[model samples]
Target: MSAPGEKAASELPQRLWLNGRVLEGRKDFERALENASEQERPVLEFGLRWCSDEPEMVLHTSGSTGRPKEIRAKKICMAASARMTVRRLGLRAGDTALLCLPMDYIAGQMVVVRSMLAGLRLVARRPSRRPFEDLARAPDFAALVPLQVLSTLEHEAERSLLAATREVLIGGAAVDRALAARLASFPNRLWSSYGMTETLSHIALRPLSGPRAGVWYEPLEGVRVSSSPRGTLAVSAPAVGVSLIETNDLVVFEPGSDRFRVLGRTDNVIDSGGIKVPAEALEELIGTVLESPFAIAPLPDPELGNSVAIVVEGTPDLPLPDFRALLRGAGLSPYWKPRSAVFVERLPRTRTGKLDRTALREAARSAPGRFRRAL
Candidate 1:
């Protein structure tokens, strides 16, 4: 077998079937780029690089936790990653794989790569909340963000199309409790992907429906996982060229089993008084009750060191006292309850649509008048 990152040119796929157009070989792919539309250019440009003699491809991080940075990913490793997913999902040649995510990101880029390697037909669509709008037929497989999934579920036509899709992978952000509960009854196969740019997409997947549906994520075959001293996840999957990646995500393993459940990110932990609370965990719990967009952030406290605050998008729906009562009703401890609520025009989010907790915390500290405390 060829070593990782060293696949021979002859072994690579020679043709790309993109959006009903067949472009064979590097020369043909390059020729079509001149007349490609704005939406088609990103795919063709990335395809151009993939067809080149370069061993690695340039990609960028989502910057959900911090700053987004560029990284060079090995093509051989990407091929390996594609193969793992294709094999696990039972994707066959000539199957249609939907590409509705932005090509600039790994999740979107991997869809194209997976199509090329597996000989699957690539169905290109602009990234949007309504990705399934006006679709004549459902794709055989697809990768979608949580927002897209939510939007599709709201409309009858789109929801039907989504139900008809053979398999679907939801990623790019955490699926809120409400959305997960709705997806639990979905007729088709649905999975939530757990990974980042460094892993070149998802290293683990949790089924959202069927008998396998649960909180724990099962790592892909050939991937090894362990909990770090800080209770974060550490991964080693050489098949994808990842020797070891120490992630900031806090996780708890299933006793001796490799399966694990992500609690939250350690960096997003809120230290209130002497107790430490995971912001994501609090937000997930709050999501079950709150219907609006909100984030749990740490506010500077006089004695408790840091106190939890709810930053909500748009105007406040319920009064401050009622919101506090709701939290208490949801089983939140006194320390876990938000000391106050802040109303913003919009909640801060990363470019990839993830909650920007660092930004939200800074905004809360910089502005005091925005916070309305419950008497």
Candidate 2:
């Protein structure tokens, strides 16, 4: 067994199907590669190398949970993942697939690989805030982030593309309640992928729209699921060559099945008066009302040890009592309802666009009154 980045270049694929046309012969591809933009060059180079006898590839995590880490993604694992996607999505040779995500990440890389394996026509587009913009044939399949979906649905012209798409995979972040509601009737088949860079992409998928709309994430074929002592989720998928990648994500598995519903992350747990409140879960619930960035966090308190609080972007327009009323109206317990609300000009986010909860907590702690109480 050769290690990753060590396999000697042996047989290369006959042709590269790209941008609605098949590039025959290596010379044609070399010319296309030379013309690739700086942003697209690296992944295109990677795709070329991956087509060789190389057994593995290196991919980086998104750092949404914490810090980004480099890990090896086995080429064999990627092929398996591609096969699973093709089978599950009903993709066939000559199908049109769109690639609008950054080629640096696994999500983007897999799009390229899937096109090759499934013999689909790959249409490459630079990743952007609105991936559906400009002139291009409607894609039979597409993959996107939740943020992109949110932005796309806001525009009638852009959203029609989603409706025309046969299947669209949404990942990279949890879908908030507001977005999920819009996805419920979204004409296309929408799926929420669950996995990380280490797993080569997703080991499980949950339907976000249509007849199968539900909370459970059904693991991919040949993937096993279990729980750690701390109640976090663990994955064992041979397709990805990962024996067990223990994750900080907390989930509730079905009584005796592999399907599970992701609750939140262990690190994001807010223990308020013995009741475990998943901040992300609460945030999703509150997302139905608040449009701007906001987060649910714990505030220091003497009696309960920790109290529920919310930090929203800009001046809080909704009255404090109304906010609580919304939570209560949604069946949130008194303990789950936020006791205090804080407003910030902007909710801090990490370089990767992840919510900087730690920073927001500090800001709320230091200047309690400035943004606290009512608007």
Candidate 3:
């Protein structure tokens, strides 16, 4: 609809996969960059790369584990991944989608790519801890980090607006039990996605609410999951060009089942004498009783090779003995209970929201006495 003397709206450029800007040439893309906001520039740059004649573009891995690296990603493979999501989610033309994650990452780039391919109307917003404080409309779809969801749930109007979202995807980090408990009966279809940078986006999704909630992540269409000799996850999905990529995550796979549960990262396993203790498992146990931001990490021991220690962001409500008693009450194996506790101002996190274990371990090792004490 147009007012008198107003020109009709032009169709979005299919080649550049854009709706707002006219990108008829490289010059137009460059011009958009000059006028774009800091938050908007990342995706606009990505859009320019897509518009270029080159078949491949560089994408940086989310350095949650280690250093970030740039890898050449194919547009064809990216489109295939987008199409797979379209089919899996049953998205249709003109559906409204909220794009909030940083466009520099695959998750954010895929939002734009998917919306372009599926003809979904995109509403782009800057990434924030509170995702929808400003947006007025209830989008049909949205992808958000757990922190954003948690913040949104704290507000009545925000929660209601979020509840109206038809398809909600949570990722960028593991959704903890506490967060999952809050979303157990969300009005819409909520899923916790699992994937990495190399996979383009999620290859599996865990149901977070409804009757199907609380299960292992089921593989997406065209995805095959297996295990390596060391119990690490192996994925094969040619549609996204991933072939038998052995992940560092250790898992338990059923003999003939497609669903698998991730236990922990092999690198995080701590060996004390002959006993192997998984830090992730210990962290889960501690999470059961401790509400504050905390982690289970291995602290070097002169007697044993390493000992399990609790690293918390701040002081807990109860004293050390009470906390230890709480751990004992949780039925945490006597041998597995953290022998000590370390307090820090805050836990370090990677750009993509994963815990910065290397940084935390370094800090703990450097100043064990400054913040750590026997529990």
Candidate 4:
């Protein structure tokens, strides 16, 4: 495989399908490439001759917690990933696929790569709030982010398009349980992809229905998975990536089974009074008892060293004691309950719509006179 930026002049130019029309052919595509290259100050060479055997594509992290940077992955690995997906889903040549995600992300790139590798026709559509509404036509398969899936569930036209699709893969963020339940009512095969920019998309796919809606992973062939002593998930796939990727996610292993359920991120764990508490697990527990969305983070506590605090999305109508009692009933140890419950209109989010933890911590520290230890 040629490295990124080294393309042979003899190689055929790639096509672009957009909004129900094949707007540009090879020559047109070349012109557009030159245009973008000039605008972006082309650091890499141009075209087949200039392109490498294994072309590199840079994926930018969403930067939910900090600034985003580009991570490079080989084009050959992407093709391998596409081939694995085709075999996993039983996709055949000539199948039709809809591309609805922003082409800038890994999820969107996988759609195009899969279509190319499978000899399937591609239909590219503009990003919209109603993603499936303006589809050129119903397709055999498609990939969506979680938010897009939720939007489809709420709209009749989008839902119809979704039902017509043969296979659908959803990722980019956690697939909320409520949204997954809504998708279960449909006839299409729904899958939740588990991966990241570093892994070149997903190394594992968990089906969304039929006895294993949210269970273990049926890993791609050649992908090796193992858990660390700390319960973090790790992967080594020759065709998928160059090296073993260690994720910050925590998982629960099922005895006598090959599957595992992702619990939360390891970075979110808080150590208080010699006990390790997963802030995400507590957030979900508190989310059930509270009326609105909230985040749990470790705040400085002179006594316990670091104590947990709750930050709500909006003002709560319930009393402080009521909230505390709910947690008590839920079996959160006295020390695990919020040291203080702070009300903020909305939690800060990153460009990719994930919680901004760094900013949230700062906000927690600046809140006036709200520090009261629960224990």
| Cα lDDT over the full model 1 | 0.85
Please give the distance, in angstroms, between residue 79's alpha carbon in candidate 2 and its true position after superposition. Answer: 1.5
Model 3: CA > 4 A from native: 1-28, 316-332, 368-370
Give the Cα error of residue 369 in candidate 3, in Å. Answer: 3.1
Question: Compared with the true structure, what per-residue lDDT tens digits does model 4 show for residues 140-257?
Answer: 8888876677668777877888888899988776665556666766677889888877788888888886566765666777787779877899888877554787788898777865
Give me the candidate number with maximum lDDT.
1
- Put down candidate 3 lDDT per residue, 202-256, tens digits, no spaces: 9999989889888488889999999899999999998777877999989887568
How does model 2 score by TM-score?
0.86
lDDT values of the candidates? 0.85, 0.77, 0.78, 0.68
Order the candidates by TM-score, highest first — what do you get? 1, 3, 2, 4
Q: In model 1, how large is the Cα lDDT of residue 243?
A: 95
Residue range with the least summed lDDT across 10 consecutive positions in model 1 = 315-324
Worst 10 residues of 2 by lDDT: 5-14
Model 1 / residue 358 / CA error / Å: 2.9
Per-residue CA lDDT of candidate 2, range 17-65, in tens?
A: 7764576544565677877775456656766667555566778877665
TM-score of 4: 0.79
The candidate that achieves the highest TM-score relative to the unseen native structure: 1
Worst 10 residues of 4 by lDDT: 39-48
lDDT for each residue of candidate 1 in 1-375, tens digit (9 for 90 to 100): 566556664457757788899887778878889898766788898888888877788899987787889988888888889998998889999999999999988999999989999999998887888999999999999999888898898899999999999899999999877888998888889999999989999999998988888898999988999989988999999977799999999999988799999999999898998888888988888787777778888888899988888887766545434545765787767667787787777777765566776688887676557345443
